[model samples]
Target: MYECYLTFRSITPCQQAQRYLTGQSLRSQLLRTPKSIAFKGCGYSLKLNDTAIGLAAAKLRQANISYGSAYRIYSDGRVEELYL
Candidate 1:
């Protein structure tokens, strides 16, 4: 399975995004933004399946929720930055 990580400006937006995604029928998990990718310290993020990435982004856009960045994580542990 493919995975995607979406970063938010702060924990609040991250949590909000999680709830929004859940209500939209997408599964997500809350996790800390990886230190290497996080420009700021200790920010929260949402971990989601790749298949839901597009729909999730669209919903977040429609809801006017902003995100910092996104990344696609590979099975072998490599990560590629994603433009939503």
Candidate 2:
């Protein structure tokens, strides 16, 4: 299973994005941004499958929801930005 982290500037947008994705039938969960990449003390993000990444990002973009960035998470705990 492929996983990716969708980061946001703040919690509200992060939550909004999560709800929005769910409405679009994409499975997502609110999660703390990995400590190594977190921007603030309580940074939050949306974790979703890679298969849904493109559509989720597109929906957020269409809704004008802002996101910080996206990262593909590896099983070994490594991460790399998803260049959308």
lDDT of 2 by residue, 5-75 (tens): 88987889999898888888988989888875675566888888788887899889999988888888777
RMSD of 2: 1.7
**TM-score attained by model 1:** 0.85
Cα displacement (Å) at residue 8, model 2: 1.1
The 10 consecutive residues of candidate 2 with the worst lDDT sum are: 34-43
User: Model 1, poorest ten-residue lDDT window?
Assistant: 33-42
Tell me how many residue pairs clash in candidate 1: 0
Q: CA lDDT, every prediction?
A: 0.84, 0.83
Per-residue lDDT tens digits of candidate 1, residues 13-58?
9999999889889899898887656777779889888878878888
Clashing pairs in 2: none
Q: In model 1, where do residues sit more than 4 Å from their true spots?
A: 75-77
- Residue pairs clashing, model 1: none
